[model samples]
Target: MRLALGVQYDGRPFRGWQSQREGGTVQDELERALSTFAQMPLKTVVAGRTDTGVHGLGQVVHLDTELERTEFSWVRGTNAFLPQAIAVQWARPMPEPFHARFSAFERTYFYVLHVSPVRSAMLAGQAGWVHTPLELDAMRQAAACLIGTHDFSAFRSSQCQAKTPLKHVHQIDIRQHGNFIHFRFRANAFLHHMVRNLMGCLIAVGRGRYPVEWLAEVLESRERRLAAPTFMPDGLYLAQVRYPEIFPVPAATLTSVPWSAVWSDPASSS
Candidate 1:
């Protein structure tokens, strides 16, 4: 039987999501924990692989296992082996056809930026820092060009292994609450560093370093060099993944995250 697991992590301590020979990644730790619990090596397929310093609020993974256990047992048992930074949030027996990555229809990500001249010690690694003020209107106008289907080649990283650069960006919402700027991106799929690359450009426009039209030009140029440098991963979070109704994945969103109390989902419609 195939088992699906919901996971959440702080991500600061992990090398990244993917497993490596050094075994410092979130996947490596998770697999090791699962192996110990099952008394057999268990490999898992993730819905999305987040980079180092990028947190996971609603990440999903699936594993094929013959081990039968209650859902609560799976969750509590797995948590018993995991570090404080990571934990299995929920688990369910999945239909054989429910492949984690392939079955996902959409993904949502959020970036939290602390806008202050002097960084807050409390939010050090929890958020990205910007020393100056940004024009929210400018960022919104520039981000508007990203909505709809398009080839996001310019925003893709050179190391990205995705088969195609084309992606559908369903929605983007930029909001500012006091000293923080929150960016929400919902897309069919994101290329490696795509959101970070887009963030850099949008920030530039907000800072008046470039015009709103520049983002459109960069998109049309399809040249990675034309875009701003990729932003830091510390503030990035894999907020949610949407799958077909056949699965019993939870629908609760960004509201459940630790940061939600301060940086909740935007009130506007997508």
Candidate 2:
């Protein structure tokens, strides 16, 4: 039988999601735990592979196993052997046709930034920091120019392996909460470092380093060199992945941070 598992992890300690021969990745740790629980080697395929320093709030994975275990057992047993920073939140028996990656119809991400002049040691690895005061309206204007299908070559990393730069961006929401700013992005797919790259440009516009119109110009140029440098990964989070209705997976829970309440209020500043 195939099993799908919801996973959450803090990526500060690992070398990204994919397993490496050196074995310090989130995938390696989870596989080790699953193998230990199953009493046999087990492998998993993930919905998305995050880069180093990027966090996962609701990562999904699928694994095929012959051993039969109750849903609760799968979660408890696997988590028992997993590290403190990595966990199997939930598990369900899935049909053979269900695939974590291919079945995903949309993905959402959040980038949280500390906009204060003084940085907080507590949020060092959890959020990005910018000492300059950002103009929220200007950032919103810049983000609006990117809300559609476009060849995003200027926003993707040179190492990106995607066959095409074209991608559909459903939304780009800019919200402010006191000293922090949140960037919410929803899309069909993302290229390597795409969000970080875009964030770099948005920050430039926010700081008045570039005019809002410069964003559309960069998009039309299709030249990576024309865009700002890729931003830090500490603020990036894979917040959710949406699949078809046929699969009855639970929706990802949002973080209970004080700023999260703003997400549900349509009247809140954006």
Candidate 3:
């Protein structure tokens, strides 16, 4: 049977999402755990691959398994064997053709930055701390310029393996509250390190290092080096994965809220 899984992981301990020859990785740990729990070889496909040190709250994956175990127990059993940094939140039997990566409709991410003279001890590892203050309104304007479909070659990582530089960015929201600044974005898909690169460009505009018009200029140029430097992965979060249709919930559970509501914050939309 095919099983879909919702997973959360702290990317600090692993090399990246994909399996590696030397270092640990989320995929390596997950495959090992699934193999032990199912007593059979289980291969899994993820919706996205987060770079090392990134985090995920709503990452999705699909696994092929021969055992017929309760979906709820599969999650619990997997978590029992996995390390503390990775947990399987839920699992459900899926149709044979269901694929976590190819079937995904949209992927959302959040990049957090704490702007202050000094980094906050509370968010030291979770947020990127920039000592200089940034202009929140300017950042919002810069992000607004990135909305809609475009060839994001300028903003994509140089090492991106995707065949095309084209992508549809549904939205890019910039928001600030006290010292916290957030860049939340939604898209049909993302290239390697795409969100972090956008965050860097937005910060440049906010700090007056780059003019607001520079964003559009870079987008039009389609030159990878024209964009700002990539921001650290500490602040990036795999916020959610949107499927084509409502997925089955575990037995006796109430219907889930819409995917939009799961991470919606009007305050961040501006």
Structure candidate 2, residue pairs in collision:
none
List lDDT for all candidates, in order: 0.90, 0.90, 0.81
Which candidate model has the greater TM-score, 2 or 3? 2
Q: Per-residue lDDT for 247 in model 3?
A: 60
Quote each prediction's TM-score.
0.96, 0.96, 0.91
Candidate 1 lDDT over 167-266, as tens digits, reads 9999998878888898889999999999989999998998999998999999999999989999888899998898999998875355665567644434
Predict model 1's lDDT versus the native: 0.90
lDDT of 2 by residue, 9-108 (tens): 9899999999999999999999999999999999999888899999888899999999999999999999999889887888989888999998998888
**Model 2 steric clash total:** 0
Weakest 10 consecutive residues of candidate 2 by summed lDDT:
261-270
lDDT, candidate 2, at 172: 92
Give candidate 2's TM-score: 0.96
